[model samples]
Target chain A: MGQQALCYDGTWKGLLSLIFDVYAYKYSISAIVTENNAIQSLLFTSALIHVVTEDIKSARVTKGIITSVGKKGYLELYHVFLSEKEGRELLILRTVQYYLGVKEQASKNYAHADVLEVKKIVKSVSRERHRMKAFIRFQLLKDGVYFAIAEPDFNVLPLISKHFKDRYADQKWIIYDVKRKYGLFYDGGEVQEIEFGTENRLDQKSISLAGHESEILYSTLWNQYFKSVNIRERKNLKLHIQHVPKRYWKYLNEKIEMGG
Target chain B: MGSRIQEKLSILADAAKYDVSCSSSGSDRKNKDKGLGNTGAGICHTYTEDGRCVSLLKILLTNHCIFDCAYCVSRRSNDVKRAAFTVQEVVDLTINFYRRNYIEGLFLSSGIFQNADFTMERLVRIAKKLRKEHNFNGYIHLKTIPGASEELIFEAGLYADRLSINLEIPTEAGLKLLAPEKNHREMIHPIKYISNRILQTKEEKKIIKSTPKFAPAGQSTQMIIGAAKESDLQIVHAAQYFYTHYKMKRVYYSGYVPISNDLRLPAIGTEVPLVRENRLYQTDWLLRFYGFEADEIVNDMNPLLDLDIDPKLSWALRNMDRFPVDVNRAPYEMILRIPGVGVRSAKKILAARNFEKLRLEHLQKLGIAMNKAKYFISCHGYIQRYADQQSERIKHFILSGSSSKYVKAVSTQLNLF
Candidate 1:
């Protein structure tokens, strides 16, 4: 039973390093939480222990996971971690500890609650990742860089970065997560994470000030195309709203009412 | 948007909305040259008011037609504002929309303005310019104009990702009754030619390293449902013909939306309930993925689909002798036939059962709908009691159990597409 809690930095590598220390230090943790979550962990249990993050420890745990569960299984664990769902760290740490002990592909054992939850959480995260890719609406700025703002449900920027980089290899673009306050900038050659801080977060007016002369024309044309393709006979607002939910409509070019 | 180009776009897009082959999958085109976009699984950029996927910039070259088909909105006799986009306009629109991630790619269809050859050449020219001039590698679905010269249609396969020629009506008699000028013979020729050419190109590529790709996403076609007095069995037979003969990626069954008051077609204001269109799609899925044949879904005896339940449930209800399948021992094919077990759940059952015997709890964990599947399957923890009941009693039990108000509302929505 994990009565005493172990805390580390809120990073994937930090979790892995904690798993490394779990065996080295021989500390039985009742719960695995981030130091960022340490203040709230006291509500459940008063005892909180903070551990240092070490690169060598995390690297060893990473190799062990890949060797035991394979590449796809490792990514599933990473997505479950990234999902930051309630009690996710404890669920993964326990399942992985059990999987490392067994030779069979125990991570895929749906009979166990931990294995099933990992799959379910990964599926939801992957769905959100796909929705982000489909719903990203970019604007052509005056500086010749395409810019878009996304507010996804999960921390999916790391997941979708490769898809955008490979598909839009020629263009310079930035996809900034407004909620996360961090953005990814791909300048035709490299992808770099950039931050605007809380106060300097970018807005539409400032973004549009640097927009190209042809930007308005293209967005307006997109809005027009969005309206024209609908068949009136098959109109079902319930289904339409289900496919493209109201939450994503704020950034969609067609959903935004056109100003005449 | 400017008035002139915007006007043409609305006119052409409004004209081309009915041809619903909006899938952007099957193309292995990579953006290797650092061009614009690439194709993978289809992505719906947004949905229309009718809930159809707005994946492609689906528009026409022009809305002015030479032939008058009673089911068509762009018929020569119809009174509408006709407009057309020039070659450059189509190319520019596709590029801009693609760069902004507004659409997957272009779906350029057209009404025959002059002759079939003249119109097809213009459509091909647009595809060529997008590929060679702009290096646009996104999914391009070109409409293969019927009766166009064989060489011209072949050229379209070289540049476009998918090619289609609509059968319009499912059966020959339906085509004759709806449009006397059109015949199944002329429409089927180009599809057959393209199919042969695709196979021939694949054969060449196996030996020669430099052979170019031809319609890498394969082909698809759409048929208007409920237009002619054809039975559902005829529609399923026609769809099976396309899939088996051509190895088609899809055969879209679009419900007949009455646009005109033609005596041969459904009159205006008669709504084609989405339920019928949705049922045909379910039957299509059963045939293609569930190892079920065309005759099994519909036959001379049961020509029409049951409007109350799905085709799979209807088939299961009629053949109740095959119930109470042992999930722990039954094959994947058998598990797929169970009412609530989907393709994904069936695969998961086979995978998870390799480690341990799958029980009712494991099946529920794998996301199988236990409500209906519980009656058909017996696992370690649960045994079916309803399998011994009469067909009518079981049907009524399942139907009433699923008639929650939320389920009733969502069932009306066409989420199957």
Candidate 2:
């Protein structure tokens, strides 16, 4: 007859379990919905809704993807989930279908529609990861810990923690993603994930609470150095904006005086 | 911007901007538990308005000089304000700027003061204090003063990651004309001294465990382009000699920016040959990475590069009798000759084609710039109908994208660095 509709809890594991149900019940799924997205409960429809998030089923599906496409492909699947694109769940499900249906290796066959869609999302996430490495500048706090706040367009904190952890091993630092309401803290030993309480949003006062007295002195020196190094004989604002866009001004200490 | 340190930074930084080598790569140093910084794959924290990469605290120890070079802004005859930083001031500025993530490390050069040995001694002391006293482990690129003693040159290499001595003019005749005080032998002496020590240490490190690294990033040098009447072939020959003989890591080409109105130099308002500078860089890349020789790019017949097309595309158009190679079966070297296929895509095509024959659509998905590569290659499903077309028509087709409006807009004006 027709395909059935399934609702999940909108997690990576929850989506994997839904995939397991698709094979177990031998019924094609028309759509997948999370709880936040209210689905209409219409009458006289061939729909089977369930909250089936079995740990065993999710683990099996993850193992199958790893065995088929190697470790790099597995990471691309995770990146697809972390993306903020709408209807990414269904797009990921279709990619899994294309991977299993083909006889030859499908991930290398970029001509496939499902593979192309997933690679596009992976490219976007990796671009954000590179920009984070280039644009994230830390400020010295009063407690000797360097702190900075960034609101990247993608969820890239997990992807960029190792870079800072290796480079700044002798100091303590915290990179708080204000938009995601979480932070990554490296306290001279190891990295840990932290979260602020629900009531307090990161504001101006909270950002400078741990500021040392000499922080302003160093910042002004940096601003002066930034202006001094610029060769006015060949000034091109177009190229400068291309590398450091306007959206990332707040995170950069030197660009703050430019007033965006 | 009017503080004492700010004043010195402006003067010193402006004096040092003409040296177009700001790279912090070629050395991989890890941070010790007590240190505050480490080096990675050359992070450019910021780009100047000229689009040049700024990875290090590029500044001079002092602007006081004893010699007068006609093209130099910091020549002794020029009436610019004089400034100098103390040894402690440079160490502190580097540490603080590095701690705040403003730069990767320090690039300290200076105008000759009193004598070559005296000036070299001061530069070595600043690097020594940073390494031994402060326990810093970041990238340090020091400019080696000509005629310094062998003992001091060896000591500087022990602390610095990379050392360089600029060959400002390509030929000895050009050097004699523009820079009266400098000769080719004095400049090449330090480069050879540093290169021999680097080789000697490589052998020592293999046997002894605690030998201590010496200039692990190797050495690089820069030559000013368009400052004199040297041909492109002459410049490429000089670069090839450096790469083959000196084992140079890189050769940077700086388009000469006019500064003075001396009869020996161009007028102050003369335009910088930026396009020729870019073409020379492309030719240098071919020598270092693309398995092309110096004579293959510019010969006696073609003494200069065609400023309209890049060096690689120019090579391909001249040798079009070797076109229409099968992408599904061509070797990796041949695949690299295609106009749009870079090093990355060439490797990808080699790996992907073993499983199945590739098509035009598959090539597009693999990130090939098809608009340019379509005229030179064939696949399982597609071949260029214009493969036998005249070279001029094919060149126009390839360059039509830029010839429409993009090249016209930037032809007269200087492009980004």
Please tell me which predicted candidate would have the highest DockQ against the true structure: 1
Candidate 1 regions off by >4 Å?
A1-3, A39-49, B404-417
Top candidate, metric lDDT: 1
Worst 10 residues of 2 chain B by lDDT: B408-417
Residue A144 displacement in candidate 1 (angstroms): 0.4
Off by over 4 Å in 2: A1-29, A32-68, A93-107, A198-210, A258-260, B404-406, B409-417
lDDT of 1 by residue, B1-417 (tens): 377898898889989998988999899799977888899858888999888998999999998999899999999999999998889999999999999888889999999988899999999999999999998889999999999999898899999999999888988888888788888899999989988888899999999968999998988999888788777899899899888998888999888888998888777887665677788999999988899998988999899887778888888888889988998899889999998889998888887888888888788879998877887889887878888889888788888888743345335533322
Candidate No. with top TM-score: 1
TM-score of chain A of each: 0.93, 0.86
True contacts kept of each: 0.78, 0.48
The sequence of per-residue lDDT tens digits that candidate 1 reaches over residues A48-145 is 77778889999999899889989898999999987978888888888788889978888777777788888989999999999988999889998889
Q: What lDDT tens digits, residue by residue, belong to model 2 across residues B155-220?
A: 999999999999989899999998889988999988998888898898998999689888888998
TM-score for each of the candidates = 0.96, 0.90
